[model samples]
Target: MKVAVVGGGPAGYVAAIRAAQLGAKVTLVEEGELGGECTNWACIPSKTLLRAVEVYKEAAEYLQDLPKFDWKAVQSRRWAVVKRLREGIEKLLSMNEVEVVKARAQPAPGRAVKADGRVIEADALILATGSVPAPLPNLPFGGKVLDTKSALLLEEPPSSVLIVGGGAAGAELATLFAKVGSKVVLVEVVDRLLPALDADIGRTVERELRAMGVEVYTSSTVLSVDDRGRAVSARLKTAKGEIDLEADYVVVAAGRRPNPGPFADLVKTDERGHVVVDGQMRASAGWVYAAGDVAGPPYFAHKAYAQAKIAAEAALGRKAYYEPLAVPAVVFSDPEVASVGMTEDEARRAGYDAKSARVPLSISGMGLISGGAGFVKLVYDGNSGRILGVHAVGRRVSEIAGEAALLVEFGATVEDLALVMHPHPTISELLVEAAELAVGKPTHIAKRGP
Candidate 1:
């Protein structure tokens, strides 16, 4: 089979490589860097910067008079990390014998794509064009008004920044700037940070951000923004009332719109412009498949990878499907937040007899020693005792996501989790602790009164 993949991003490149591995002749096309925005601008770069801050904060707790942080060195290191990863992706594509083309591409009527004035014929086409930042009205990206991508490229951290939106991107940016000595005022139209996750997770993150001196205004919207030469002035409609603020930059991390490119006309798209795909990652058009940001929400690269592999295999006459019981999400804020499967409310809404238990990280020996303040929450079927979801917020909690996902995926019961002897003096024990509490076998913490 001849496969032509559009957009050399996480979804596109992975689809191309997988298709090639399955003995298909593949050609990957991209106008920008191989790893796409996640590699060059969004995930990799932001996390690299955040990791530096994380290390510094960890060291400052014990060490005195640490060397001053060099913004230039940090920026250099971020780019170096991006470059190395981008090269690795390129090497992988080469090793798999997938042909790569650098140019703008458009889908044609047949199972073909037109790129740089050449028509590339293929048996299947995968669209993974990703997405572009959604700029707020009257606050177009320019000058002192920045999008997430432009915000990362600033020569130096602004003295002050007013960030709009409190999703994963907004929350992480607030953490980055606040830690780096920038006065950050984060405004979110939603009721809390990370509104998509469990409510308690957002509450925990908000507390941590406040401790870092970040002014958070949930249920707020930017009414207007006026960019002055040296700074930007903005008016906000907050929960309290209207408030005006000025800052060196106004970052619109509000959201992102799918960039399906020319394929939107060729395929069925959601009201939000995301390409609609089925369990097999198959679009309405039998010959076309879409993955990644262009496919829809929970816009994590790992989700894209799963969808891409399914699309590639299904396109190549395989019976692969993209059914997953749980997809974990993580926010790299201070005291990282990670959640998998249903929240308690979601479980109940779906008609499960849901009961939940939450235990503070302080209950764990490692958590106490690490001084991380957060909680592990477990949502389970009260009747059957099956674990439905696991949500956690604290230092190194991101590492617990895999175990949480597996338990939910396998329909493991609270007893199943509590019975397994987890390693001692580890943050992961918090899960076991929460499970024990749910099963009426409390350990490390006193049981609540009935």
Candidate 2:
């Protein structure tokens, strides 16, 4: 069988490699870089800068005198990391014997694609064109206004930045600039930050950002931006009243827009333009598939890998399907946040009779030693005693999300988690403690009736 995959991003590349491994001839086409936004600009570069800022922040706490950060050096290292990872993906594709074509590929009639002024036909086609930062209305990109992608390519940090949106991307960028001595004001239109996660988690992250000197304005929107050569004056409408916010630059991290490219007619799409796929990652058309950011929300590269594998296998006449019980969502902010499965409210809304318990990281020896303040929340079904979700926030909590995902996947109960012995003086122990509290047998913290 011959397979043609469009967009050599996390989804398309993985699909190409997987199909090739299944003894199918694969051809991968990408308009730009192989790793897409996740590699070239979004995830890798942003996190690289975040890590550097995190290190500096941590050191500043202990040492009275810390050396000033060199933005150029950090940018150089960011490029190096991205280049190395991109090369690794290229080598992987080469080893898998997948033919890669670099061009803007458009879907041609009848299972064929048009790229580089030629038509190539395949038995099956996979669309994984990924996404771009959604443009903010009225305030267009360029000059002093920047989107997330353009913000990443900045040669130097701006003197002052007004970030419009308080999601993961906005929060991360706010943290980055504020830590590097750039005055930052993060404005969110919603009542809180990270509206996708639990309300408490958002509140916790907001507190952490404030402690780092980031001015957060929730329930606010950027009305207009006036670029006057020297500075940009933004008119912001808040719940209270309207005010002018001046900054060296205005960054819009409003979210992302799906890019199915010229193949939009081949698949069903949601109102937000995301491609809709079935359980097996199959599109409306039988011979076509879609994955990654183009497929839908909770957009993570790891999720794309799973979808890619399923789409590839199914395309190869295999019995593979993508039906995951829980997909972890992680926000790598100062006090990192991670969650899997439903939130307490979500479980209750789903008619699960949900009960929740929270154990503050302060109670754990590791959390206290690490000098971070956050908590672990465990949501479970009261009737069935099945774990519904795990939400964590604090230092290194992102690493604990894997175990939390496993529990949610296996439908592990409070007792099941409490019975597992976690090592002493570690953040992992907080999971056990939270479970104990949920089951009405508190270990480290005082028991509260759930």
Candidate 3:
């Protein structure tokens, strides 16, 4: 059977490769260059901008420990990296034996896709078409009223920026602006920064941002933005009533929506405009599968890849299905954040009697090695001893996301992880220690002898 994988991104390309691996004639279509929003705009570009910020922060804050870092040269080289990576993805799709079509994909049911006035019919269709930056209705994004995408594209950093959201994207960019020497003040409508993150993790990051001189406001709203090409004046709602905040730029990192309206009449998208898909990434409309950011949240690239693999299998008349145990998330902020599985709230909602343990990384061996400051939190069921959730916050501690995710994925207990030997003085030791601590049999802790 022939398959047409629409939207050439992590999802589309992975699906194409998977379909080809399954011995199918696969053709992939994308409106832009390969890698979709990830390479072109979202994940990849955001990281490019933050790399500059990370280096700059490391030089000043971690100078003695991190070694000599060329701040100026490193930041300047991002464009070259982005340019090279973008080209590499294009080349990868070409080498995959999947015919690549660069044209806007018009989604149609029953394994049909239209592109730039040409119709491609296949036995199966994979709609990996990605997402767009969420619209700000009253406060529209323009030249000065920027979104995360535009914020990354600036040749020179602004003097100051007022970020309008305190989620992962907003918080990361706020850190970026601060590192690049922008006087930044992040405003969130919620009670805390990164409401999506666990309160403890969010608090840790919030404290770090405050220590870095980035002003954060909880329970605040930007009423409207007055854009004047070079600056934006915002009327905001705060505890002390209305106040005006001025900045060189305003970033709307509040949210994102599926890039589906173009293919609206063709697929079954939910009320909120996200493409609805079953376990195998199959759309309600037959033979049309959806994956990636367009599919839903916990919107990590890895999740999309997994979904794409299953979508490819299902498209080929294989009886494969997707049963993801854990979908991990890592935020690329200064003292990064990572999580997997359910939140405590999620477990409670699902009617599980849950318990969680929070550990500050200041006590870990790896934390001492990296001269650490942050935490590792493990949330699990009290009765079952099965891991339900895990959250981490620390400087470079986010790299251990894989190990943390593994424990959640396998339902590994604290004692189970304690038996596994971890490399001495590495960040992974923290995960081992955190899990051991969970079973009330912590190796490193002072145990009361029987």
Candidate 4:
């Protein structure tokens, strides 16, 4: 099979490599750097910077007279990380014998793509053009108004920043700036931060952000912005009332929109312009496939990787599908938040007799020693005792999400989780503890009457 993959992102590159591994001749077309936004801008860069803040805050607890943060050095290191990863992708593509073309590609008729005035014929086409930052109303990206990509490129952290939207990016940025001593005012149109996750997760994150001196205004929207060259003044309609704020920069982290390029007209797209794909990651046009942010939400690189693998295999006449029982969502904020499967509300809405148990991280020996706060919540089918979801927020909780995902994926029960032995003095024990509570075998916390 001859495969042509568009946009060398997490989705495209992975699809190309997989297709090549399946004995297909593949050509990957990308206008920008390989690894796409996740590698160059959003995920990798942001996490790199956030890790810097994490280290500083961890050291501050025990050290005295810390040196001032060097933004330039951090920026250099962030780029270095990006560069190294990009080279790794390049080498992978080369070793796999996947041809890479550095040019903008357009889907041509008859399972072909046109790039740089050349038509590349293929038996299957994979679209993974990724997405761009969604612009906020009355606050276009320019000058002091920044998007997530541009915000990371700033030479120095602003003395004050007003961030719009309280999703993963907004919350993480708020954490990054506030922890580094920048006054951050975060505004989310929704009622809570990370509105897509469990309500408690948002509440925990909001509490932590407030502790970091980040002014959070949920159920709010920025009405207008008046950029005055040096700074920007924004009028916001918050839950309390209308308020005005000034900041060195106004960052619009509202969300992202699919960058499907010329393929939108060729394939089925949802109302949000995301290319609609089926279980096999096949577009309405059976020969074409779409993955990553361009395909839909829960826009994580890992999700892209899974979908890309399915798309490549299915496209190459293999029996693969993009069916997953649980896909993990993680936010790298202070006291990181991670969740898998449905929330309690979602489980009930899905027609399950859902019940949940919550156990604070403080109950764990490691959590107490590590100064961790927040709780681990397990939403399960009350009748069957099968674990439906796991949501957690705490220091290093991100590591637990993999196990949480597996529990939901394999339909493990609360009893199963409780029976499994977790290493002693580890934060991961919170899951076992929560499971024990759910099964009426409470440990490390006071038992409640049924």
Candidate 5:
């Protein structure tokens, strides 16, 4: 089958690679760079800048204890880190023997695609056109008013920034700027930051942001942003009253919107313009499909990868389906934030009769060794005693999400976790303790009742 993937993002790129591996004739079309937003704009660049802030923040914050590194030296290294990775992605697709077409694609099902005034036919068309930052209805984007995509491209850190939105990107960037010694004020319209995480987890994350000297205001709205050439004036509505914020730069990490507005009739999309896919990552029509951020909820790279594989395989006449038991959500902050499966609220809302256990990693040997504030939370079905959700926040806990994620995938109970032996003084050890604590026989249980 001749497969053409639209969009050069994680979903599209992975689908192309997977289709090629499956012995299909695959050609990928991308409008901008090869790696899509995740590689070029969204994920990779944000983390690269965040890493710079991590080093800079730690040295300055822990000057007496930790060895110092020159801030200018670290700042100088960021361009090299991001540029090389972007170039490396371009090389990888070429190495895989997949034809990389650099153009914006207009897809016609089971027919051909038009890009850059050229036409190409394919047996299967994968639409991974990805997303762009959602616009604030009252405010426009320009001047000192920037989005997360533009924020990463910045060479010098802003003296002060007002970040709108409290999702992963907003929260992460706010913390990053604060760590880099920028005065960052983050405003979320919701009741809490990281609304995707459990309320408790969100609370903990908020505490961490405040500790970093970030001005976090929940239940707030950015009424308008007026650019003043060098800076911007933001009219915000806080819980207490309306307030005006002075910002050298205004970063909007609000949300994202799916592309291809005209294709909604040909495909499935939710009310908010995100593509809707079935269990097999297929649309209402058998051949039409969607994945990645465009596909709606739990928009993460790993989820996109899994969805792409299923979408591509099924498209190629395979019997594959993409119903992930656990889709890990990882936010790479200083101490990181990782979550899988349901939140406590989600469990209760679903009528699972669930109970939860929360354990601060500070009590764990690994937390002490890492010299960071870390914590883990496990939510379980009270009747089935199966693992429902796992949340961790700490240094390197993002990497350790797999350990707890597997338990979620396996429908494992606290008992199931007891059998596995985690290495001592490691981040993963906290997951086991959290699971054990949920069952009331934990070695490091914090409390008796949930």
Candidate 6:
């Protein structure tokens, strides 16, 4: 069988490689960067900048004299990292014997992809065109109004920025600029930052952002923006009523919609233009599969990677499916926030008798030594004692999210987690201690009264 994967991103490249491994002739097509948005623009570049900001923040207090940060050098380093990783993807595709074509691919007549004025016929086709930023009405990408792509390519940090979304992307960028001495105002239409996480987790992140000097205005919307050359002026509607604000740039991190590209009419997409796939990652047609941001919500690179494998295997006549009970999300803020599985409200809405417990990270020896302030929250089924969800916020809590994901995925009970015996003087111990608190064991701190 021959397989053709369009959009050489995390999903497309991985799908191409997987199909090649399954004894199929694979052709991969990409118009721009082979590593897609994650490597070229979004994930890699943003994280590299954020990491530098984190280092400066960690040392700012301890050192009396700190050298000024170099924006050009940071930009150079970010591009360098992107270039190396993109080359690595290219090498992997070559090793797998997948034909790599650099061109914009369009759907051709009958199971074929047309790219660079040539058609590649295949028995199966996988669409992974990924996504583009959702544009705000009246506030398009130009002048001082920027999308995520343009925001990262800024020559130097802005004197002031008004970020018009409080999602993970906006929050991370807000934290980055505030630490780098830019006055930042983060506005979210929703009631909290990181709206997808548990409420308390979002509140904790808001606190951390304020600590870093970011002025956060939740339940706020940017009604309009005017670029006056010298500065951008924006009218915002908040709980306190409408107000006018000015900044060097207004960033719209509101959200992203699936690119779909040339495959829009070929497959079924949701109202928001995301491909609607079955449990096996198959779209409207059996021979046509979709993955990554083009596939749907969550829109995570790791989720795209997993879906790529599933789509490839399913196309190869294998019994593979993308059935995940828990997906972990991490925000690389000063104090990282991570969450997996259901929130307490979600569990209850799903008809589970859920009960939750919280253990402060400050109580742990590692937390005390590190001087970090955050907490671990565990949501479990009160009736069956099964773990429902795990949410955490603190330094390096992103790493702990993996274990939380596993417990939620496996349906581990509070008693099971409490008995596992986590190592002493570690961040992970908070998970066990939270579990103990849930099962009435009380190992780390005094048991809370019912």
lDDT of each: 0.93, 0.90, 0.80, 0.93, 0.80, 0.91
> How much is 299 displaced in model 6, in angstroms?
0.8
Clashes per model (N, Cα, C within 3 A): 0, 0, 0, 0, 2, 0
- In the range 6-66, model 5's lDDT, one tens digit per residue, is 8778898889888888888888888788777787677876787777667665566556665
How does model 4 score by TM-score?
A: 0.98
| Clashing residue pairs found in predicted model 4 | none
lDDT-superior candidate, 1 or 2: 1
| Total clashing pairs in model 3 | 0
Report the lDDT tens digits of candidate 4 across residue range 245-340: 899999999999999988899999999999999999999998899989999987899999999999999999999988899999999998799999
- Across 1-450, the per-residue lDDT of candidate 3 in tens digits comes to 889988888888989988988888888888787877777777777787777666556566655665444444654676567678878876766677789888877755455778778788888878887777885787677778887888877777788999888998998998887876789999998989889878888888888888878988889998888887767888989867989878998888988888765666677888878888888788887867888878887567888898899899888888878887887888987678888888888888888887777667777777765547688877888788788888888877768888878888888876677678988777777776766777767766544444
- What would you estimate as the lDDT of candidate 4? 0.93
lDDT of 1: 0.93
Residue 286's lDDT in candidate 5: 61
**All candidates: TM-score:** 0.98, 0.97, 0.93, 0.98, 0.92, 0.98
Better of 1 and 2 by TM-score: 1
User: Which run of 10 residues does model 1 get worst, by summed lDDT?
Assistant: 363-372
Per-residue lDDT over 1-450 for candidate 1, one digit per residue giving the tens place of the 0 to 100 score:
899999999999999999999999999999989999899999999999999988888798899999877788999999999999999999999999999999999976577899988999998999999999999777788888899999999899989999988999999999999998999999998889999999999999999999999999998889888888998888999989999989999988989999998878999999999999999899999999988999998799989998999999999999999889999999998889989999999999999999998999998889987665999999999999999999999988988999999999999999999999999889899998999999888988899888
Using TM-score as the measure, name the better of candidate 2 and candidate 4.
Answer: 4
State the TM-score for model 2.
0.97
Write model 6 residue lDDT over 1-450, tens digit each, in one string.
Answer: 999999998999999999999999999999998999999999999999998877776787689788898888989999999999999999999999999999999989998989999999999999999999998887888999999889999999999999989999998899889988999999998899999889998899899899878999999888889899989999999999999989999999989989997689998888988889998889997799998999988889989999999999998899998999999998887678889999999999999998998998899998876657899999999999999999999887888988999999999999999899888889999999998899888876997677
Give the per-residue lDDT of model 2 (tens digit) for 1-450.
999999988998999999999999999999799999899999999999999888877888889867788889999999999999999999999999999999999878898999988887999999999988887888788899999988878888998999988999998898899989999999999999999999999999999999989989999988899998889999999888999878999999988899887888878889988889998889998999988899997779989989999999999889988889889988888788989999988998999999988999999888987765899999999998899999999988988999999999999999899899999889989999988887788977876544
Alpha-carbon RMSD of each model: 1.1, 1.4, 2.7, 1.0, 2.6, 1.2
At residue 289, what lDDT does model 1 achieve? 92
